[model samples]
Target: MSAVASETKTRQLPYVVAITEGVREVLKEQANAFVAGEDVAGAGSVYGYYRGLLDEFGADRIYDTPISEKGIIGLGVGAAAAGLRPVLDIMFMDFIGECMDEIANQMAKMRFMFGGSATLPITVLTMAGAGANLAAQHSQSLEAWLAHLPGLKVVMPATPYDAKGLIIAAARDDNPVFVVLNKMSLAMMGDVPEGPYEVPIGKANVVRTGKNYTIVTLGRMLGQALDAAKQLAELGIDAEVIDARSVQPFDTEAVIKSVEKTHRAMVVHEAVRFGGFGAEIAAQIQEHAFDYLDAPVARVGAPFSPVPFSPALEKVYVPNAERIVVVAREQLGI
Candidate 1:
């Protein structure tokens, strides 16, 4: 069993359901918290994670807005600034382009621009990743964009547990937080604790322990990395797998500690390899654990092309366990 699946006692739930529960719990906990986005209430979200939320919370708390991404985010920024905790939905991660000004300039820099006098306790949830053939426009893992901005917390949850926990944690945080979710993993199931719980932002989870190598993965790549670890184990390689749940306030200590022990590290993500967050992680590893490294840190990610619409092309576009194994062997020379 995988490290996450090995845990017992917690009930199993789909990643999509966990998100619903997380948002529901957040609204229940925070009286001022409200959910706003296009088709979120009536459509129960384009992914069904927000299903039944309208019936449960009513329109006062759950709102369905127009199809304007900028307006949706603008409303969220204004509402959050006015002392209400808003859980805004940016239907698709790619839609962030429409609201970059609200996100980058207003939501991200407002608190700092005001010298900590203002707090934007906003949680922006958006779907990312390339699978289910959503194509380039709809299926881009753009977490790097949000992570690059200052004063914004970026988190990518790979499993159902992290999805629910991270969402709740993001909602509770005082600063603006982006819960970058994977649309392809919505149907994936995992053990999740019941009720409101936090997975804590800025912390990395070492899912699989090994002595030889460390494979730090972000978002949906956690499963692929674990699969690759299993494949490597068959060939006399023990690989430690770390889930980088949060990227901006990255858990450098966890990754550095792992690299210090294993003396070899690689970072992987679904974003474009040219300037993905993997580059940032690889750089951090070299800086913090240069003496411990036995080889240059490796990175695995997609090509710098747009996500393909065809299933055949997408299968080749997105990085998989085979690609990870190939890169690992080339880097480790084994």
Candidate 2:
């Protein structure tokens, strides 16, 4: 094993660094594991998450590829089918359009298509969200697009802890998992365990507990919901924040249980409010917990338009904590 792979640090690191640590750990234990992405080794990735991985694991394990999402995803799909675990670092989630066949058809359906005789453990690490002002082409929270596909496990980690655990779990799973790391949360830091661990896929995390209402959100919106919860507390309103980390194998039970207790629920996300994935959660909560609700489940998300390029417009484009607070108030009839 390389020196970087051998040494494990216990100190707190940013979300990106924690992800790097997870990659390093995965490569060490799984000798068949390799990371391939555009500019990953040459430029330390488009986001600097793999800065020191190339030097530690050498060019063979951690390397760059053509500026092609199709090629990178193809490599992962092919390598995974041949008994090698490969993680494709798609620079931006928006680029998923370039390799829909490889992802939605090939990687996603490999094991099932092979009659369960194969283990296609391919992890596609991609960035999602619109806070960086990279224009519409570069900035988009496309988790909803991938979640709609079958045979794919989708995870959106909002904290450093979930980032590392989910990626590690995705790497080790015998199925294709998309690790949708939000760009806005890359710098957000939290206490991450030193040893190898997993937050477990298909689970919901209740970051804050309250009895009045339940806030179901994931990725960057999770932080916004938590912040809104504190402000709602001042108004004698208790809000429970549920981080729907695994969007595909969604933990509907946890959400239903929360709503059953609170009798109210709100769904929030950074994606476009219209036709966004939040609509799915809202529908499910209402369908399963309808009898326990006091009012219709509210949703908070971006406006129904392309993400703006200008900083001022982008600021208004993404959902914020204040909007969640306002929606919560409206639901309470306050």
Compute the lDDT for candidate 2.
0.88
Q: Rate the local accuracy (lDDT) of all candidates.
A: 0.93, 0.88
RMSD per model, one decimal = 2.6, 3.4
Give per-residue CA lDDT, model 2, range 83-199, as digits (tens).
Answer: 899988999888999999988888878778889887789888999899898989888998888899889999999888889889888998888999999888888878777878777
Q: What is the lDDT of residue 270 in candidate 2?
A: 91
Q: Report the C-alpha displacement of residue 251, candidate 1, in angstroms.
A: 0.3
Instruction: Give model 1's TM-score versus the native structure.
Output: 0.97
Model 2 regions more than 4 Å off: 1-10
Query: If scored against the real structure, what TM-score would every candidate get?
Result: 0.97, 0.95
Q: In candidate 2, how many Å is residue 90 off?
A: 0.4
**Residue 222 displacement in candidate 1 (angstroms):** 0.3
lDDT of 2 at 107: 80
